[model samples]
Target: MRAAGFAPTTATYNVLIKAHCSDAAVPIDDAVRLFQNIAKPDVCSYNTVIDGLCRRGRLPEACDLFAEMIANGIAPTVVTYTTVIHWLAREACFDDALKLFDEMSGRGIMPNVVTYSSLIDGLCKGGRAASALELLDRMVRERKLPNTITYSSVIDGLCKEGRLGQAMEILDRMRLQGRKPDAGLFGKLITGLCDSGRALEAANYLDEMILAGIEPNRLTWSLHSKINDAVVKTLCAKGEVSRAFQVYQSMRTRGISTEPKTFHLLVECLSKKNYLEKAAHVVRDMLSERCIPERETWDTIVRAYWSKKKVRQEAEEMWSQLTVTN
Candidate 1:
C-alpha cells in the first residue's frame, strides 16, 4: 500500500502489530517498534503490545508501557488489567498482582474470570490456599463463575495443605456447577486422602472416579494404577480383605497391573481369612501375570487348603503348579 502511494492508517498498523506479536517467528521487538510508530495509538494498540511483552517475560517493560498508556490519557480496559495481572501471577508476584486487582476494582473495572483465575492460581501456588479460597468466594459473590482451572488450583492447593475436607467440598461444588472433574483432579484428592491415612475414604473416591467416567490418559494411566494399589494395600492392612479383593478385581478388569507386593498381600490375607478358594484364584492370577508370589504367601495358601479336607486335592495341585512355575 505504501508503494502504491497509500499511507497505512493507524488501524492497518494495529493489525500488523497484533500479527507480529502472535507469530513466534517474528520478534516481539518488531511489534514494539511498530507500536511506537503509531501516531495515534488506541487501547487495542497498547493492549496488544502489552500482551506481547508479557508473553516474552518482559514484565517490567510491560508495566512501564502500561503506565505510559495511562499517562497518554488513554484509559486501560479490563483486558489491559487482566493481561498484567495474569503475568504478575505467573511470575510469582502475588502481592503485586493483588494490589493491581484492588486497583482495578477501585477504578470501577469489573474483573472477569480470567482475572480471578489468575490471582487464585498465584495464591494457591504461593501456599496460601486459604486466601485463594477467600478469593473464590468473593468471585462467586461477584457473580463470576469459576471454571475448571480455577477450581483445580484451589483443590490442589487445599490437598497439599492436608485440608482434604475442604478440597472435597470444592470438588463437589465444581461438579454441581457442571464442570467435569478429570482424572488428574481425582488423583490429587485420592493421593491426599491416602496420605492422611483415610484409605477407606480414598477407596470410596476411587470408585467415584471410575463412576464419573474420567478416562485416564497416557500421562495418568500410571497414576490410576498407583493409587489403586495403594488403596488395596491399605485396605488389606486394615483387615478389610473383602473390600481389597473387590478393588483388586476392578484393577484387573481395567487391565491395570497389580504390584507383586499387593498381589501377595491380597492372597495372604484371603488365606488367613479362610477364603481358600479366593486365595487359590488370586495365586493363579499372580502366576498368569508372571508375578512371583512370596514363599510365605505360598505357605499361607497351602496351610489353609490342607486344613480343609474338602479341598485337599486342590491344595496338592496348587503345590505342583507352584513347583513347576518356580
Candidate 2:
C-alpha cells in the first residue's frame, strides 16, 4: 500500500503489529518499530503493543509503555488494564496485579470475566486459594458470572490447600449454575479426599462422577485408575470388603485395569469373608490378566475353602483347576 502511494494509517499499523506479535518467527522488535512509527496511536495501538510485549515476556517494557499511554492523555481502556494485570499475575507479581485491579476499579472501569479468571488462576497457582475464593465471591457480587476456568482454578486451589469442604461447595455451586464438571476437576477432588483419609467420601464422588456421565478420556484415564485403586485399597483396609468388591466390579466393567495390590486385597478380603467362589474367580482373573497372585493370596483362598465344611469337595476340585490353569 505504501509503495502504491497510499500511506498506512494507525489502524493498518495496529493490524500489522498484532500479526507480527502473534507469529513466533517474526521478531517482536519489528512490531515495536511499526508501533513506534504510528503518528497518532490510539488505545488499540497501545493495547496491541503492550499485549505483544507481555506475550514475549517483556513485562517491564510493557509497563513502561502502559505508563506512557496514560501520560500522553490517552486513557487506558479495560483491555489495557486487563492485559497488564494478567501478565503481572502470570509473573507472580500478585501485589502489582491486585493494585492494578483496584486501580482499574477505582477508575470506574468494570472488569470482565477474563480479567477475573486470569487473576484467580494466578492467585491459585501462588497458593493463595483463600484469597482467590474471596475474589470469586466479589466477582459474583459484581454480577460477573464465573466460567469453567474460573471455577476450576478456585476448586484446584482449594484442594491443594486441603480445604476440601470449601472445594466441594464450589463444585456444587458450579453444578447448580449448569456447569458440568469434567474428569480432571473431579479427579482433583477425589485425590484430595483420598489423601485426607476420606476414602469413603472419595468413593462416593467417584460414583457421582460416573453417574454424571463423565467418562474418562485418554487424558484422565491414569487418574481414574489411580483413584479407583486408592479407594478399593483403603476400603479393604477399613474392612469394607463388600464396598471394595463393588468398586472392583465397576473398574472391570469400565475396562479399567486394577492394580495388582488392589486385586490382591480383593482376593484376600473375599477369602476372609468366606466368599470362596468369588475369591477363586478373582485369582483366575489375576492369572488371565498375567498378574501373578502372591503365594499368600493362594494360601488364603485354599485355607478359606478347606476350612469350610460345606465346600470341601468343591475346594479340592477348584484347587486342581486353578493349578492347571496357572
Candidate 3:
C-alpha cells in the first residue's frame, strides 16, 4: 500500500509491527523504525513495539517505552499490562510483576485469566504456593476461571514443596471447576512420588492415569517402568515368584516395557525355583515384546525345561535356535 502511494495508518503500523515481532527474519528494530516514523503513534503502536522488545529479551527498552507511554498520557490497556506482567513473571521478577498487577488493578483494568495466571505462576515459582493459592481464591471470587496451565503451575509448586495432598486437593478443585487435568499435572505428581521413593503410590497414580485415559508420554512411561521394575525386584528377591509373575503380567497388560534386567531377574529366579511353566511363559512374553533375554536367563530356562520337564520339546527347540542365533 505504501508502495502504491497510500499513506499508512496507525493500524497498518500495528500490523507491520506484529508481523515483524513474530517473524524471526524481521528484526524488532524495524517495528521501532516504523513507530518512530509515525506522525502520531498510538497506544497500540507502543504496545506492539514494547511486546517486540520483550520478545527480543530487551526488557529495559520495553520498560522505557512503557514509561514513555505513561508520560504521553496514554492509558495502558489490559493487553499492555498482561504482556509486560507475563514477561516480568517469567523472568523471575515477582516483586516487579506484583507491583504491576496492583498498579493495573488501581487503574481499573480488571484482571483477566491471563493476568492472574502469570501472577500465580510467578508467585508459585518464588516459593509462595500458599500466596498463589490465595490469589486463586481471589480469582475465583472475581469470576475469572483459572485454566489448566494455571492449575498445573500451582500443582507443580505444591509437588516441589512436597505437599502432595495439597496438590491433589487443588487438582480436585480444578476438576470441580470442569477443567481436565492434563499430562503436566499427572507427570509432576507421579514424578514427585517416585522421587520420594514411594513407587507403590506412583503405581496407584499410574492406574488412575490409565483409567482417566491419559496416555503416558515417554517420560511418564519411563517412570512407570522404574516403579514396576522396583516392585518386581522386591517381589523376586523375597522368593514370591507367583506375585512377581502377577506384577509382570500387570505391566504386560499395559504394554509397559521395563528394564531388561528386571525381566531377566524374574526369569532366572522362576527357573531356579523349578517354576518351569511360569518361566516358560515369561520367556514368551519377553520375546513377543521383542526383548531378548540375556544368555544366563536363557540358560536357566534351558536347565529348568530339561531337568524339570523333559516333555517340553518346544523349549528345547527354542533354546537351540536361540543359541545358534547368538
Evaluated with TM-score, which candidate comes out highest?
2
Q: What is the C-alpha lDDT of each candidate?
A: 0.90, 0.90, 0.82
Clash counts per candidate, in order, are 0, 0, 0
- Candidate 3 stretches with Cα past 4 Å from truth are 1-7, 125-127, 216-251, 261-283, 295-326
What TM-score fits each model? 0.83, 0.86, 0.76
lDDT of 1: 0.90
- RMSD to truth, every model: 4.8, 4.4, 6.4
User: What ranking of all candidate models by TM-score puts the best one first?
Assistant: 2, 1, 3
| Residue-by-residue lDDT tens digits, candidate 1, 1-326 | 98999988889999999999999889999999999898999999999999999999899999999999999999999999999999998898888999999999998999999899988998888788988999999999998999999998999899999999999999999999899888778888888887888888989999998998865677888988888998998888888889889999998888888988888888889988998788898999999988888898899888887788767877788999999999
The parts of candidate 1 lying over 4 Å away from their true place are 215-223, 237-239, 268-276, 290-326
Which candidate, 1 or 3, has the higher TM-score? 1
Give lDDT tens digits, candidate 2, residues 161-203.
Answer: 9999999999999999899988888888888887787878888
Q: What is the lDDT for 205 in model 2?
A: 94
Which tens-of-lDDT digit does each residue in 55-89 have in candidate 3? Answer: 88998899889988999899899999999998888
